[model samples]
Target: MKIALAQTDIMWEDKKANLDIAETFIKRAAEEKVKLILFPEMSLTGFTMNVEVHGEYYETSSKNMNNDKSHWNFNRTLDAIKQLSIKYSINIGIGYIEKELEESKGKNKYAVISALGEVISNYTKIHPFTFGTESKYYCGGDKISYFNIDDFKLSTFICYDLRFPEIFQIASREAELITVAANWPKARINHWVDLLKARAIENQCYIAGVNRVGHGYGIEYNGNSLIIDPLGNVIGNCLEGVEGLIIAELDVDLVHNLRKDFPLKKDRRESLYRELAGEIIESIH
Candidate 1:
């Protein structure tokens, strides 16, 4: 399948402008016959902590305006994106802050929309960036999610989730390609690139890391969005400090063949790891 990573420069808390930019990228990707287009974390809004502005309401109407806040105006943007995806006949993966009716707080979520305008997979970020104080405003998700597109089994994870390999290991059990949407800063960009390669190498799957460029919340981002194959080779990259699309074709057979040849997962000692973890927990108690 052909996939495109949109390394965008998010307008700070400006939904309409960002929506327009996102559409432009989606259209360009469609012209290349890309099957899936991915955007960075908080694609519409620069990583802002102000929930009142960027947070979505539990129940929102595209026509109704409860207030003038950007959060309340997200439904309209979502509707527009859905229409664009249907019009272009392309799948889309975008990130946003979603508010649930059952909970008072919102969660960082990545929504995967099919070409037919159907929401096939909605994954909330399991690990919020605590160092950035994201945990203070958004609730963390508890589980990972996977979905399929034709012959490819795909999964998604947010920015900080890349640091945790256990979830990737679990997802790799069923997923051939994994997508990561991030708002990572330029200061730690080396870590981002290294971890992405590590995850792909360790899991024997394709990894796509889509990150943003430009400055946000007083921090600058050097877009190092990348696509790595199972052998940890970078098939495509957007490079640093550029707002553009990086396209790559992924082969599912490569994943299967590499896993079969390496057979690393078959030798995992899960029982030993669990016992050691239990012992550590007991000692802490």
Candidate 2:
């Protein structure tokens, strides 16, 4: 599968401007014939806390999540991206705020739309960045989610979720590729690459991490978007501190063959880990 990492310069809290920028990137990637293109977290609006104004209503149960725009809270960002996906004949992985009725907060979500512009996998961030006060405004997801292209399955995750490996490990049980859409700051970019390498090596699956570049909320995000192989090798990078695209051709057969040769997942003790964790939590109490 040929995929693209679109490192973008997001306009802070501005959906319209960001969408225009995203459209240009989409058009460019389509011309390159990229099968799937992934954007950073909060693709349109930069990592901002202005959800009340920017948040879009989502029909959590709808099969055609992107096309069903009848909800009064639905916004233009969703509509534009769906049309872009269909018009360009390509799949898109984008991030947006999903307003939740219960908390009046939202879920930081990454959703995948098929080439036909049908919603495939709509994943919520499993870990909200409590350090950044994201937990106060967003609810964490309880499960991992995936989308398929033919027989190839790719699990989805968001920014802070990458710090927790347990979810990625669980997702790897059935997925060959993991997509992490993040807006991680420039100061801790080293951690980003190192963690991604570790996840790819441990899970024996391809990791595609797409991040944004430029400024947001007065913080710098130097895009070090990468496509790493299961062997923990950095096969693709779109240059640091700039907005660009990294194109990579991933082979699922490589994952299958590598796992057959290495057979690492066969040795994982899931129940043992759970038992140990349970005892730790009980002891703390």
User: Which of the numbered candidates is closest to the native, going by highest TM-score?
Assistant: 2
**Residue 272 lDDT in candidate 1:** 94
Give the alpha-carbon lDDT of every model: 0.89, 0.89
Kindly state the number of residue pairs that clash in model 2: 0
Tens-digit lDDT track for model 1 on 1-285? Answer: 999999999999998899889999999999999999999998898787876556663334334545545534345445666898999999999888776434556789888889998878888899988899999878899978899988899999999999999999999999999999999999999999999999999999999999999998799999999999999999999868989999999999999999999999999998998999999999999
When summed lDDT is taken over every stretch of 10 residues in candidate 1, the lowest stretch is: 57-66
Cα shift from native, residue 143, model 1 (Å): 1.3
* Weakest lDDT window of 10 consecutive positions for candidate 2: 59-68
Per-residue lDDT for 2 in model 2?
89
Q: Per model, how many backbone clashes are there?
A: 0, 0
Candidate 1 deviant stretches above 4 angstroms: 57-74, 101-104
